[model samples]
Target: MNATAKLDEYIPVVGQAIIDDLKLLAERLAQKHVLHVNSTAVGGGVAEILSRMVPLLGEMGINTKWEVIKGGDQFYQVTKKFHNVLHGRPDEVTPADFEIFMETSRKNIAEMNTDYDIVFIHDPQPIALIQKKGQNKWIWRCHIDVSKPHPIVWAFLKEFIVRYDASVFSAPSFSQQLPIRQALISPSIDPLSEKNRELSPEDVDRVLAKYQISRDKPIITQISRFDRLKDPVGVIEAFLMVRKYIDCQLILAGGTATDDPEGLQVLAEVKEKAADNPDIHILLLPQNDFEVNALQRGSDVIMQKSLKEGFGLTVSEALWKVKPVVAGNVGGIPLQIKHKYSGMLCNSVEGAAFALKQILNSPAFAKRLGENGREHIRNNFLLTRHLRDYMLLFLSLDYAEDLVYL
Candidate 1:
C-alpha cells in the first residue's frame, strides 16, 4: 500500500555495504517478472514476508506480484491435515482428502495466470500449479519442517515437488532429499515493519492495559498462530511449572490463518487447559503487527515452545527487540539462539520452566543475553539479508549450469 521502502532506509541498521550489494544484484535481474503464489494473503508468515518483499522487489527494478490461491472449506480442511502430517504428526489422510486437494488445485490452475519470468509456489497448497508451468522458471518454497514427514503424505507431495526447477527451505535440517536443487534461505523480520519497529513506553503500556493484562509481575509472552505444532498447551504447562518458583504471568496471544482449519480447535484446547489459572491469559488477537510489537516489547521474557517449527520467526522477532527468549531447541530455533548465549533453548516443559525462572531471577544474565541476541539478529536475520538472498537466488536460476558466486 505504501511506496516500496527504499534500501537506503536499512543502511543505518544493516550498513551501507549490504544495501550496495543488493542494488548490484537487483540490477542483474532488472525488469524480470517474479510472481509469488501462496494459499493466504493475510495470516501466515509466507504472506507476511511477501507483503513487504514484493514491493521492495519492484523497487529493485524487478517486476513482482503476489497472488493467493482459492480454496473451499473442505479443501482447506484437507490441507490442514496435510500440514499436520508434514510436521510429523499422525494424521490419517484418506484418498478422499487427496481428491479434494487435486480438485481444488485444478480449479486454481485453470483460473490463475502463469506468465512470469520466475514463479514461486509456496508450500504444498499450491505446489501442483507447476502442472501449468510453461517456459517460465518455477521455484517451490517449502516453509514447513519436512525432514521427518509422514511417509504417506511426503510420498504424495513428492510427486508434485520434484517437478519444480528448484526448492527453497528455511533451514538445512528442514530440507528433504528432493531430486531438485535446494536452497537454505531462512525467514527474516523487517526491522522497519510495524511488528518489529521501535515503540514508545507509552504505547507499550497502552497496549498492555487495553488487553487488561496487569504488570504487577513479570510477563512471559508467546506470539504465534494457535497451531498444534506451536505447542500452546505445552507453553501453558511450562508456565505452570515456572509459577512454583516465580510469580509471573503467561500470555498466549495469536490469531488464526484462513487455510488452517484446526486453529480454533487448538485455541479451545488451550483455553480448557488454562481454565483454572487466572494468571494464564489466552488472548485470541487479530493479525495486528503493532499489538504484537508492543506485547513483545512489554514482556520481561519471551517463549516459543514449538514441538515442531519451520524457522520459528517469532524467536528472531523477540530477539530483535533485545528480549531474552526461552525457545524449543528444535527446527531452526537453534540457528537463531546459541543456548545460554543469545538465549536459552529447551527440549521439554521442565527445561523451559528452568530457563524462565533463571532469566526472571537474574536480571543481569537476562540483560546480557538480550543484548547478544539483538546483535545476532542485526547481523544475520534482518529483512535486508533476506532480500539479498532472494535477489541472488533469482539471478542464480539463469546460470543453472555454471558455478555462480553470490
Candidate 2:
C-alpha cells in the first residue's frame, strides 16, 4: 500500500473524520522537508516513535527524514549522565562531561546535513545541532521529564535549547519557564506496530514457552529498558509483595540501548534484587516486538511502575491491548491514566502492590479499567493523534495565527 493508504489502515481504529482532518493538514505541509535527529537508531521511545512516524509522514506527502548523530562511547556516557541529571537523578557530572558532549556534537555538526524546512531534534544528545541552523525553522522535542533538572546541567543545555524556534514537551508539568514558545505534545505508540499489535492465543503461548513462562499463574509483566528511572527493581519488590498472597509470576523483560551505558549495571541490580527466585523471570529481551506483544497480550495485568517518566509508552501499549495497568503517578503517565478509571496509578512500591492485588482480586474492576483505558488511548495516545499534533506544530510556523497555544 501507498503511505497515505497504509495510514488508512488506522481509519478503523481512529475514525474517518480524524484521517480526513489529517489529510487536510497534510495538504498544508505537502512535501515540506522535515529532518529528525537523535542519538541512536535503535532502542528508546524517541527512536520507536520516529520509526513509524517518519515513514507515515512520508506517505502523507511530507518529505520526512530521520538522522542519527554519530558519537563514540565517551560521548554517550556523558549524554546518559545528562539524561539522569535532567530527570533529577543524582549524578556526578564534571566539566569533562560537557567537553566530551560538545566534542562529539562538533563532529556531528560538521558531518550532518541540517538543511530542511523544519529541523526537529529529539532530546539532549542532539540539542547542540542547533549550531548548524540556517534560516530553517528549528524545533527541539524533549522526550524526558525535566521538571526538576539540576541547575548546572539545565543551564548548559538551555544555551542550545533557547536557540530553537520552539520546544515541545511530553507533558505540561515537564515544561520549564523558557523564553521560546512551547508546545505540549505527548509521545505515542503505533497500535499497528508489533509491540502493540494483537497476538493470537497460540502465538502468546509460544512466546511464553520460549521464555519458559507458564500460564498456570497470573503474569505481571513490565516491558522497559533496565533503567533505574523505570524502577524494574521496585517492580520486583512489588511483585514479591503480591506473590506473598497471590500465585503470580513476575517478568522483567528489556534490553539496553546503544546510547545508554548504565543498562547492564541496572540489569545487574535487578538480578540481585530478584535473588534467584524462580517465580521471577528476568529476561534481558532484545528488540523483539513480537515477544513483547505476546507477553503483554498473555498477561493478566501489566505494570509500568516508573519512578520518573517522560510519557510511559509502555502504559499506553498495555492499555491499548485492553489490559489493566498499574503505573506511577509521575510525569506523562498521569496524562495516559485517569487513576481508577482508565488504569490504576500508584505512588510507592506499597501502593503498586496494593493496586496489583486490587486488579487481581476483582475481575470486574480490572475489566472496567482495561475497557476505559483502551478508549482513552484510542482518543489520545495513538500514532494518528501524534501525527495530527506534529503536522499542526509544523504548519504553525506558516499560519502563526492558527496555533495560539504555541
Candidate 3:
C-alpha cells in the first residue's frame, strides 16, 4: 500500500471523531509556525519523534520546522553527565560543567533563528534556548524521568526551564512541580515507519545475516543506544544468568547519538564484559531503521534492561512487533508493560534474568504475552494517539482553564 493509503487505514482505527478533533485543531493552528529544537538530528527517541511529527504537523496545515543545535565534544560530555544525574545517578556535575553548558548555549543563542509562533525545546540539551526566548510561546519538553534528579543538576536546569510558557513530559511521574503549567504527553512510534512496519521472514533473516547473528538458537534481543543509563552491561549480565537455564543467544544492538559522548565508552565496556561468551552477540548497528525492525521481528524474545530511561521507545517497538518483552520497571516502562499481563517488568538483574528464563522456557506463556503486548501498544503507544495528544496540547496552551476533551 502507498503511504497515503496506509495512513488512511489508521483513520478507521483512530475513528472519525479523532479526525474531526484534528481538523478543529488544524484550523486553530493554521499558518502558525511551530519549531522544534533539540540536540541531535539522528538517534535517540526525541529525534525519532520529531522526524515523523514535524512532517505530519505540516501535512495538517501547520507550518512546522525542526532545528538541531550544534555542540562540541566537551559540551556533550557535560550534558551526558547531566543526563545521568537527572536519571538519579550519582554523577558529580561540577559548577564548571554548568559554565560549559552556558557557554555552548550562548553560542547557539546567537546563531539560531527563533522566529516562530510556538517554540518547542526538547530535553535539557537545548533547554537553554529558552534563555533567548523571543516573542514566541516557548514550551520545554522534558523526556527524562526527573522524579529523583540530582539536586545540583536539577537546580541548574530548573532555572531555565521555569522561563518557558509550558512544559511537557512523557509520564506524569516524570513531571516536576514547575511554576509553569505542565502537560503529560508520552512519546510514540510511527506504525508506518521502517522501524515498526511489518517485515517478511526473508527480510528478517537478511538483517540477521548482515549482522552475523545466528538464527539457530532462540534470539533474545535488546535494541538501545550504547549508553551507561541503558545498562548494556547489565543486559549482558542478565543474559548470562538466563543462558545457564535456557540455551538462547543474546543480541545487544545499538547505535551512537551525536549528543551522547559516552556511547563509545559504554559500547567498549559491553564488548569487554561479553568477550568470553560467543553467543552474546554485540551488534553495533548504524542509524538503520529497517534493520532495527527486522532484528526485533527475528528475535524470539526482546529485552529492555535500562537502569534509567526517558521512555524506552525500544520497548514499544518490540511490543508493536508482537514479541514478548522483559523490561526494567523504571521510568515510563511500567506505563508500557502491564506486569505479566502484557509484558514482564523487572526491577533487578536477577529479576530480569528470571523473567527472561520464563519467556524462553514456556512458549505458550510467551506467545500470550506477545499477543497482549501488541494490543497494549495498539491502544496506547501508537503515533496517531500521540499526534492527537500533542495537537490537543497545542490547543490547550491557548485554553488552559477548561479541559479540552477529544
Candidate 4:
C-alpha cells in the first residue's frame, strides 16, 4: 500500500459507493478512540490484515491505535500450545502453561495503560487483559478455529472470553455458545498490499530466477507457515501423487510467526519429508510480501490444504489473483470455494491429488474457475467489505441488548 493511501484511492478497486459508505460510518463514530491489542506486529494473517486496517481506520477520521504485547520465549510456547488445543488437538496444556500465561499477562496489565473508549483484543494472547476493563467496551476477536477445542483448554480460555462485551468469530461454526454477544466477521486480504497487488511479467520472472525455481514444467504452490495444521506434509504427498502422471514442480514457501514457537520444528519436519526431491522447492522466505505475490502470480495452481484453519486468507489472496485453488474442505475454505464452481475442495490426500490432476489436464476449465473465483473474492472477501463490517460492529457496540450479529 502507498504511504499516503486514502480510502478514496480504493474507489478504483472497490468502486465509489463502498468508500462513501465507510466515510458515512466514520462520521457516526466521530471522536471515538479505538485501540487494538494483539501479540505480534508482524507475520500471520492477524498482523497482515491489521497492517492495512489500522491506517484505513485513521483515514476514516477515527482515533485508532494498534499495540502489541511483550512476551518471552516461554510465554509464546504456552500460547502456541493453547492455539493447538483450541484447534481440537489433544490436551497437552500443563498446569505450568497457565502460570506462564498469567505471569506474563500480569506484567502486561501493569505496564500497559489500556484506557480508551474501546479496547479490541485479538485471539487468546491478550485475552486476559480484559481484567483491566473499566466501563469501556471490549471486543475479543478469535482468529482461530475453536469449533471443537479440547474441553479443558476451552474451559480455561472461556473464563476470560466471557468478560468481553462481544466476541467475533471468523465462521459461524467457530462460535461457541458464549454468554456475551457474538459477531461473525471473516478475515480478508488487502488488494493493494505487496502480497496481493498486481506484478509485471518481468517482476515475476526476476523473483523466480532469484530463487533458482525453474518453471520448465507447470508449478503448483502452497504458501503458508510451516505449521502442522496447514498440512504441508500432506501437500507434498499429494504433489508426489500428481507428479506420477502430470509433470509439475511444487513450491512450499512461508515465513515463521513471532507468536508461533512450533514454526521451526514444523519446518524441519517438512524438510525431512521433502527429502532430496529436486522438483520440490522449499523457500524459507522472510517477511517479504512482494516476492510472495510474484510467486503466487507465477504459479499455475495455488493450494491451501490446511487440516485446521481459522479462515484461510491465502485462499482469498489466490482467488483474487485469478488463480485456480485446490484447498482442504475444512474450516473456512468452503466459504471461499464452491466445489466445482470457483475452485476445488478436497477432504484427503487422494482427493487433493485428483483435484490437482483435473486442473492440470483441463486448461479451459481452470480459466473459468479462476474467473469465477476472482469475482467471488471481489464481491465478498475484499478489504472494503471487511472494513464496512468492522465499522458496523463498532456501531453495534453502542446498543445494550444483543446487537453484535453484524
Lowest summed lDDT across 10 adjacent residues in model 3 is found at 1-10
Q: What is the lDDT of residue 16 in candidate 3?
A: 72
**Model 3 misplacement above 4 A:** 1-20, 69-81, 88-100, 103-115, 131-136, 210-217, 226-228, 255-278
Per-model lDDT? 0.90, 0.89, 0.85, 0.90
Model 2, span 1-406: residue lDDT tens: 1223378898988999999999998998886999999988976678877888988899889999999999999998898888878878788989999999999999999999998999999999998999999999999999888999989999999999999999999998988999988999988878777677667899999999999999999999999889887899899999989999999999989988766679888988899999999999988788888898999999989999888887778899899999999999988999999999999999999999999999999999999999999999999998899999999889776654643632
What's the TM-score of each model vs. the native? 0.88, 0.88, 0.84, 0.89
**Model 1: how far residue 176 lies from native, Å:** 1.6
TM-score of 2: 0.88
Native-referenced Cα lDDT, model 2? 0.89
Q: Please provide, for model 1 over 1-406, each residue's C-alpha lDDT reduced to its tens digit, 9 standing for 90 to 100.
A: 2235676888888888988988898888987999999999886788878888988888888999899999999999999999978877776999999999999999999999989999999999998999998888899999988878888888988898888888899887877777888888999988988888789999999999999998999999999889887899999998998898888899999988666679988988999999868899888887688999999999999999988888888999999999999999889999999999999999998899899999999999999999999999998899988998898778777776767665
User: What C-alpha lDDT, on a 0 to 100 scale, does residue 46 get in candidate 2?
Assistant: 82
**In model 4, where is the ten-residue run with the lowest total lDDT?**
397-406
Q: Report the lDDT tens digits of candidate 3 across residue range 188-267.
A: 87787777778899999898998788788999998888987788888999988988877889998888866667888888
Query: In model 4, where do residues sit more than 4 Å from their true spots?
Result: 1-4, 72-74, 255-278, 400-406
**Model 3, TM vs. native:** 0.84
TM-score of candidate 4 versus the correct structure, residues matched by position: 0.89
Checking candidate 3 for backbone clashes, the offending pairs are none
Ordered by TM-score, highest first, the candidates read 4, 2, 1, 3
